[model samples]
Target: MHSAGDPAPPPPGGVLWSLAGDIRGLLMLPAALTLQVAHPAVGAGVDDHSVFRTDPWGRGERSLRSLQLWVYGGEAAAEEGRRLRKLHRTIRGTDTRGRRYHALTPANYAWVHATGFPVYQHASRYLVRPLTRAQERALYREWLQVGRVLGLRDEDMPPTIEDFWPYYRTMLADEVEATTVVRELLAVDAPVPPPDRGPLTLRVALRAAWPLLLPPLARFRRFITVGLMPPDAREAIGLDWTPRQERRLRRFGAVVRVIVPLLPERLRYLPRARAARAAWRAGRGRQG
Candidate 1:
């Protein structure tokens, strides 16, 4: 567990704070997860151990909650980190290549964490404004701080944005693939149930409409999943992106950029983020 001496979570109003909490940030998550499981070891671990196929909504909700905690949960962030490590203790298996893998193997674990940086960088270009060089560097530094909160040592990730790209490119070229999990995640025909959360009325409506909804939903999933991925990473993983798809994505991104900023805080940010921002403001008011 992180002590007082350990690095604090990303401070309020930083690049990570601004992005990670925004509702638009959700658009980037699938791309990051796609990049993650494109690694054979990560793919193997998820295919064998994750409930993603059987319970996609639950798995996604849980993953989202954990991600929110890493940035907005403050002291709870380190505890969440410890919880994740313990959870993955038994998640070991063999990849399609017949090599054994463990979820927490430093390189494997680090790669999963590392995917977020590039995905965030790429997605920001389309969903939000493209980050300035200073903002990009600050985002990387804050990401590293979150990594520390997740119990990653400084050596596990490249030290700076300058060092990170080469490492990312090397992993894309040498380690990533269209593994079983990646294919399933991208597959339009994969059976996924309607979300079971939300009000009873909403849940019932979703269940009734799911059959009709699934096709378009799945296609949209594939679109954003492919479109948001870094071009080099997409090519490395052999996912196709056509010129028409690029134009469509740009149109979609333009709409999102126009709309998202117009939303109020309650509408624009997730629950955890809303609460954290409120608490931080309250604390600052008291200090003043």
Candidate 2:
């Protein structure tokens, strides 16, 4: 139906997920196509690092981690996303220090809001290593506090989830132990490249963060940001998308969520200062 000069466009798997008979799905795709990024582990971790699933559960701008869950299908499908719906139901928090939501403390929330230091985020009470019986008791108390904060019952905890398994609740060492885990997974194992003595810092970061800052362009920023940003800051804000792209993105994210649980377990425990202490001894040995 065309002349020699007119070349045919690529086919969408030969009309399966295709519509309108064009092949610009890649370019014409909407921005709200969120893609869920999961971790090496699965299960409850699915909701862990999720944005909008943040602490003080019903608090300020800070919420769960939702970087890749904006939409799931084409133009029509983009309308009924259930991200926030699932988010609110899963996260848990309450004012322990006082009735005021910020009574969890304005200072602590500020700490997490600005730098995401983890101490102020959910599950922080038990992040340290219990050195003695007393420390273990204190850690247990903190664990209880964390459970209260997350709205998790004793039955919902790591130890009892898939049945009382000891593998989930590993022994703790010290506060530094949790921090060390952070150092290992992100900063240590993936050291930041020395700043290019370039002319622009914002531009460089923008270049690096462009994928997150402007995800449609690249995914490098998203990968780089994994476990680096606070759960809240790592949200799933995006532009209006088409139904098809939404469905496609969601299906893709769902697959990843299945594989990685959409969130990392380490992030959940670390904010509450969860420590994987074996790394500490390993680290010391390396240095020694």
Candidate 3:
């Protein structure tokens, strides 16, 4: 394990390095989570322990915070990874059909780890800037390196990004099953404004009228999530996608491309990315 004081080596200079910092990546959270839970074992683990139905936004935010720390928190990142691994070690249980599931199991862990590469890649290409083919390959490899930190062996991953699609397709075809948990996620069965966070104005409004707004918002989110998923994965989860949905999703992505770039850096990235950028500028200043 990497020591607390010792800086974990930086991730590769790749598309991930650019996309990891963009706020647009958050838009992929639902699709990524959907893919993760598409695997029966992974879904079982989440169904057993995750509080998504009660507090989905909190669950999502916590997941994002851990990922940000692991990917960008430098010297402290490895330690955070270790802590998470340790926590998950205690989360083992059987599914409704009595099949065993372990969150720490290597294959299960790797499945969740593998899903993020495509999510961020698509998020960048559709919402930020598109990467070159070589850059895409490099980004995929960087995530493989992250897999090592998350306790997955190299054998657990596809040999290359080009190879990953076949593996992903096979998983969707052979292993993914939509459980009740998947249905709940598709229903967006959790509160917005999180009940504990967000702007006071929004919080007050949501608290006042959440019952009226949540169903429509849930339908809207489900539509986008289905559009974001791969055809095979979308099919595995039985989400309906259509030409109209595709057009709307593309139109939304175009609007995001224009608006996101206009936001200030503080609003555009997570704190870790902002810190990384600040450090880079400071280092350049010293050399000058």
> Which numbered prediction scores highest in lDDT against the true structure?
1
lDDT (Cα, tens digit) per residue for candidate 3, span 181-255:
677778766555536578999888778887888888888778767777766678877778888888888899899
Question: For candidate 3, what is the TM-score?
Answer: 0.90
Candidates 1 and 3 compared by lDDT, better number: 1
- Which segments of model 1 are wrong by more than 4 Å? none
Cα RMSD, each candidate = 1.2, 24.6, 2.5
172-249, model 2: which lDDT tens digit per residue? Answer: 110001122222222213323323343697657756864444333224323323322222323321112345644554
Q: State the lDDT at 207 in candidate 2.
A: 62
Each model's TM-score?
Answer: 0.97, 0.22, 0.90
Overall local distance difference test of candidate 3:
0.77
Report the C-alpha displacement of residue 193, candidate 1, in angstroms. Answer: 0.8
